[model samples]
Target: MIKQVLKNVGITLALFILMINASAQKVTLLQQGRAVSIRGLSVVNDKVAWVSGNKGYVAVTKDAGKTWIWQQVRGFEQSDFRDIEAFSDKEALIMSSGTPALILKTTDGGANWQVKYRNRDTSVFLDAMDFHGKYGCAMSDPSNNHFVLFETTDKGNTWKAREMAKSPLARNDEAAFAASGTCLNIFDNGLIKSNSILMVTGGSVANMIQAHIDEKKWSTQQLPIAQGRSSAGAFSVATNGKNWVVVGGDYQRDTRTDSTACYSNDAGKTWKIAKVTPTFLSCVQHIDSKIYLATGTAGTYLSKDEGLTWTKIDGGSYNVCIKTQHGKLTLLAGGNGKIAMFSMK
Candidate 1:
């Protein structure tokens, strides 16, 4: 009888420790209270990362998130850098939105920036930028009944227009969210031998995954998320070839809990709504095949069971969360120039 009682106590203790660890996990602010609003973040490794934002603000942190070196591109103070991609501590790219959509690159840390792409038309609004090695692309809202995409093969030194014939026609009123710079992602889709550029759209079309499968074909699958208005619907998506997770909600109604998240395990043959969803989680990234971290203006959430359920680990507002592509580091960034460190251990 004593042996059984001791074994039961051990089990209870183990579970208690796990619960404590889970609850004790919270984001630690490393930077904040600045004037700019941060949305774009790129964590290249455990020790190197970068973030870009409004008013031409860009920052680099070499000691993880402990400190940052900030700079505003000398002559571009009015630009809103919506997305950033960092390849290393010294090399990075930032893409601005709004009229005069621009792409800039820096090689000597943040000291100097060279414009690589620009469009001044009123309709040109670049949303997000993603890369798979030297091959990369930037996406913009639909124009003239078609989506606009730009491709880069020589890093950020040059960019080319994707043939309009290859870019699939966009639905009426469909658009992508730039709130977190995550609505468009490019990586190996696993189904095809070549990589696929995947983009998620909102607005009247609700949430749909638009996959540029190859040079000549495009495919799509819809995600069940909040919609019906300009401010509602999916804002971000991430996939590990098989299981896919999407998170978003009405950013204008950020407190609503219904239909804010969903997941698909069979590459979008079907999707299941998250039982416990985050409120207005506009961005999501896979920590592993099962774990994911998401955030937005509402707060931050962590999911351990493939996004079916989540725990609101942080109540502080953030626009985006990202884990190191090849390391264990994770970080979150948001408005007021807030940057915080997070851990999944």
Candidate 2:
């Protein structure tokens, strides 16, 4: 009798272990709130998620997307949050449209956020922020004569300016960011784009620029530079480890395309025009080799071939912030303070 009991107990244990593994690897989304315009959203893992936007709005989700608790991130109430970068569930950073270049940090998940660094003197509307683990940097529009870039080694504890290595593009108030120093771009003849990683850059040089992380090794290429292309001035760029996509429009020309997108598979050496039409593209997120893009007022587009072809997933996407978790897609948009969520089929 004792031997038989032991055998049964072992069988049950094995079955339990298999069930846990299956549950942990699955991906899906759950409805947490109503549809509102969001500026930025990021998922650290299957459980932890974060979103930010104008008016100092920050939302956190601990149980994947099953539930979310809206919270106020300190520093700016009427400030517009444009970019957010996260190293882990416990640490993250945000860049906003404010004077003194607004940057916020939180060490304790999304429970609370404090102003870790701010530079009022160079305030020219901070646009984007990126990081290489804990060491990250940010770029701002050229407010003064000199363009500026901010760097922080110890997370967001402190920050300092790094002298730019000389750029030809007029500092006509541009914006830039990088996933890391290894995935950085210089907007000139420098390094070649890699197949393993996708890097994004934008501005007046949008669709007509080159980039490289390390200056020692050079990989230079050119982009599609034609006259009357509405999306000339790039606002932001993003990639999902497959294709690099840039978002910007001819703000100067009232008759501009809402969104301008271009991609290069061979690392920044050459770029090809994407098939989809973007109306004010904002950000992009990739999952399971599929690419999901977010655009302001133009809705959202999904592509499985790395921008080879795109299909509209949502109509009139007022989303400022969009992110993908597992197979779920989340967006924050609508100027009326509405946060919306969607699932990728």
Candidate 3:
């Protein structure tokens, strides 16, 4: 009887350990060497991914995250490429942030790049860009007290600024963050009439700017995340269907947890703070109905219940996180050229 009781206790302990391991996610470091800060990530599928960052640096991996090819756009070597939109292993577009703002496109991978747009305005700065199907748009920081919007319908071959009336004006100190290349998002509800563009702002306030693609009508809403200072506000916005999540915190004090994230089920109509929050997440992405990933200088976090709660999966610093649209591959990028692949067991 004593032997049987001991055996049963051992089995129970073993099963408990298995259950804990199964519920925990894992992060595997893939590549790290260079010192470039990687804030832009585009995972096309399980086999292809692209990332762009400061000093006009761009990296592509054709064999998932197993290998990477790094290059710097020759002439624009000094430019800080903050955002990237990738269509495949060979075609992608990159955007720069500061003065002499630029948008470049490459069709032959990173070997060659073509200038698609350039603005010498000292105040011009782009934050992020996104696309839904063939339509795409890029959001910029407020210039002349009005935020700038650029649209493209030909897969980023060309871009045109929408009229001022179509682009909304900015509030006092209201601006967007180029931290993780995810301040703007475009989505469609499988209906021609349901296409929309969503942009989140920081600085003096945290707000979401919503616009209808067909109507060009825009609306604004104040978010519940940290705000008021130039270093605080909503840094990223993401949506999967009608469910949306926004995350941000004072970048200067990245470890602070106050008002770092919120979620909305009715599009952008309302938002409620998460019961549990991650500290200073510069970027957030919805992987599926139940899984969401966020990252920042502090670390990487995963939320298994939509965005209501979160748990830290990795302590390594990162700036952005994204999942492949065609497969289950998830990747995170950050400073010093750090890149890692996430595995959920």
Candidate 4:
């Protein structure tokens, strides 16, 4: 009986070890190497996440970020991957700047990334990409005069170019970093100012506003931004499957000064500029209810009352926030060649 009990205990211990290993996968930082700049990050789960940047590098972690393994792509080792996104543990994509847009897709995680599409006919830079199941879209800088929307239905196997209205700012061929989509937003009421040219297209502001994605499909209500004066634009957008938050820039035309952040309870329909202590903001991530994180020139800010207020955590730190399993927050912060972590709790 003693021997049997010992054997049962051993089996139970073994199972527990396996579960822990599965939960905490590895997270490799490509920025670990000298002269590497970590530009973008995306996490599918706690055990699985990806990061990309200059040096044509990409890294993956399956052990909850305890360790990481570096992966390389052909003809991209020297090119910069500005943005990355993961649909699941097994699928991911990376976007880079080039005359003919460069996009990389992987099926077996980051083990092998295949070039799915490239647009050499245009000089526009692909900034961001989004894929929901087999449907996805890519956004590019509008200076190239080429359309910004590229859709793929067969799991990014093939892409179809979409159209957008021509404007003077678009130069008859325009695209913005689809990275944030029109998702780019920032605060205008704060002290941090934006020097970028401010442009507002969507809203109930008469026929002046238009929805390029859909004509009658108003999923979000346009918020009132006081009248006459325009607020800064956003650099990133995050949704908790409920509230939608936008953060980034003042849409300044030339200055790096960005001071604007907004949130909407009903998708994108209406927005209320956050009344937080004024500070420059960048990327926004929603870890959970009442818990939010935004990072940029002012570093990372934690807000418990939505974006109504913000408190700076670290100075001179740029972080891309992600949600992990078990309601944990992952802050991908550190300069090129260095990576650090800060728990949400």
Candidate 5:
């Protein structure tokens, strides 16, 4: 009877610990009501960050999130700058979706932007882009049954589309989500931890696409997330070297929890659907080896036990959440120019 009593007590203690880990952070809003719907976020460090959104809005902060200098690119007032990659307070690249796909680079902070790449095709829609040192890759929806890819060797100043033979083939109705710009990234991480480009697609089918630096071909793994429609599937993926976490659901059904998240430890060879998942997540960032953060239209969530379980710690609508590239400072941004900072409680 004493042993049984001790076992019950141990289980109760563990449950309590998990509960504490679930609500481990506090979110503080730094800005709101600016008339822009932010979807692009990049944190250069604890002291610098940038965000881009619809209506050609781009905001940057040099003193963390204390104040933001907002800009609306001239001659592109209607452009929706959905993804931004920042190298510092003054140099960055912004990509726009919709008809007449565009990529622009700004060297004088937000003062002027020079077009680096432009496509006026009615069917072309750029989704996301990421960099590895000076090498950068960008993705667009299918063209000629294959995903169009562009690469830049000098940061993002110039771009050239990869040969059509090298681009990954897309299924009949498969496409990528441009919600958070976290759905695609290039990193030297995985089982081997070498340079690999990873991208997630959603539509009639959901899949993960990977291309290794040493290999000449692209490979894919199906993600077990919401699918069969345009509004579902994986939206974001983050990894702490080897372990990977992917989160997304039917954005139209933002509150449903089933098939909303999953995890993989052995690269993309296999995955296990998270037992506890957050609602329709557009962005997820690895906070540490064991902690991760995700956010979407529903709210923001945190996971202390990797991606096994997540708890809603704040009820803020956001399109993207990110941590500083080299610092621990974390921030979230969404529509209506909402921006918030997350710090450990």
Candidate 6:
């Protein structure tokens, strides 16, 4: 009787271990390098994707994440490309942060680049950029006490700063983060067709700045996420036309799970905190109608109920996440040139 009992216990233990392993999401590293920290990612489709990062590095993969062609933009070897907008495999634009802010465009893939826009102001620092059709916008850190906004009407071929009054004034120590290149987003669904823009900020204050292309006015609202410090606040925002979600946390304390995400159904008039939150999400993207994905230094999370709750699917640090605009492919990029593709089990 004693031997039979011990044998049963051993079988149960093995089964328990297998269950635990199956529950944990698997992360398959597609490529790893130390030369660049990839924060900007644009997955045009399942077969075409582009990434830009430090050391003027830009990579493209025509076969999903299987292989990559890397190149360094000559003469801008020190530039850190934080945001990228790709229209196709042959055309793309990259924006650099910090002094001498720049927007570079490449028409011949990564073979050559042209400086589409340049700002030498010491205070000029671009945080993120988004586009719809031929119109695009890039956001900058506070300059002269107000956040700077630029518009491009020729598909990123040229850019001009909007009127100072068009942008909202920044609060003390409040600014946007270049961590994931997702602080700014533009929505242009044919139904709404209003060209609504959403920008989120952190630091001493956490707020969402909203604007419409048809209106010169911009509005700001405080968020419920963690704030009151430079490392706390909403880092990214995503909308599915009727609902919006914002994700962030005190990145300095990435393990703290409180007040890291929120959602709003009535536009931006009001917000509600998520019942369960992810930690320190640097970027969030609405994958489908009720599907959302967020990633940060702590891990990657998935939400099937429209950001109301989250589950950590992968525990690998990533700076940004983006889905293919025309396909179902989801890709993530992060520090030390890390890149991976997501697969549901």
Global lDDT of each model?
Answer: 0.87, 0.52, 0.88, 0.55, 0.89, 0.89
Better of 3 and 5 by lDDT: 5
Give the per-residue lDDT digits (tens) of candidate 6, residues 1-345.
Answer: 999999999999999976775464445679886679998999999899999999889999999989999998999999999999998899999999977899999999889899999999988889999998899999998988899999998999989998888777899899998988888989865445477888999999899998787676778999999999988988999888678899999889998999999998877688999998888899998888888889999999988788899988889999999988799788999998999987654
Which is superior by TM-score, 2 or 6? 6
| TM value for model 2 | 0.69
- TM-scores, each model vs. reference: 0.94, 0.69, 0.93, 0.69, 0.94, 0.91
Candidate with top lDDT is 5
- Candidate 2 on 1-345: residue-level lDDT in tens? 999999999999998975664343322224434433355566666566676666777667777655677766654677667666665667777777666567888888767778877677745556555554455656555545434556676876788775555322333433342211111222221243331112333454443333333332223243442223323444445554435655544434423343455666764456776766555455554444655454455555555567656555555434444454353545444445544554543
lDDT of 1 at 59: 90
Candidate 1: lDDT over CA atoms? 0.87
RMSD of each predicted structure: 2.5, 11.8, 3.2, 13.2, 2.2, 4.3
lDDT of candidate 2 at residue 326, scale 0 to 100: 50
Tens-place lDDT per residue, model 3, 1-345, is: 999999999999999986796456888899888979898899999999999989879999999889999998898879998999999999999999888888999999988999999999877789999877778888888877889988999988889998877787799899999998889988776532465878899999999988787665678999999999999999998887667899999999999888999999887789999999989999998887778989999988888777899888888999999888788999999999999998886
Candidate 1 lDDT, 63-132, residue by residue in tens: 9888898988899999999999999999999999998989999898878899999898888789899998
Model 5 CA deviation exceeding 4 Å by range: 1-23, 190-193
- For candidate 5, the per-residue lDDT at 111 reads 94
Instruction: State which candidate, 1 or 3, has the greater lDDT.
Output: 3
- lDDT, candidate 6, equals 0.89
Instruction: Give the worst 10-residue stretch by lDDT in candidate 2.
Output: 177-186
Please list the residue runs of candidate 4 whose C-alpha ends up more than 4 Å from where it truly belongs after superposition.
Answer: 1-33, 143-147, 165-232, 250-258, 324-329
Clashes of each: 0, 27, 0, 47, 0, 0
lDDT-based ranking: 5, 6, 3, 1, 4, 2
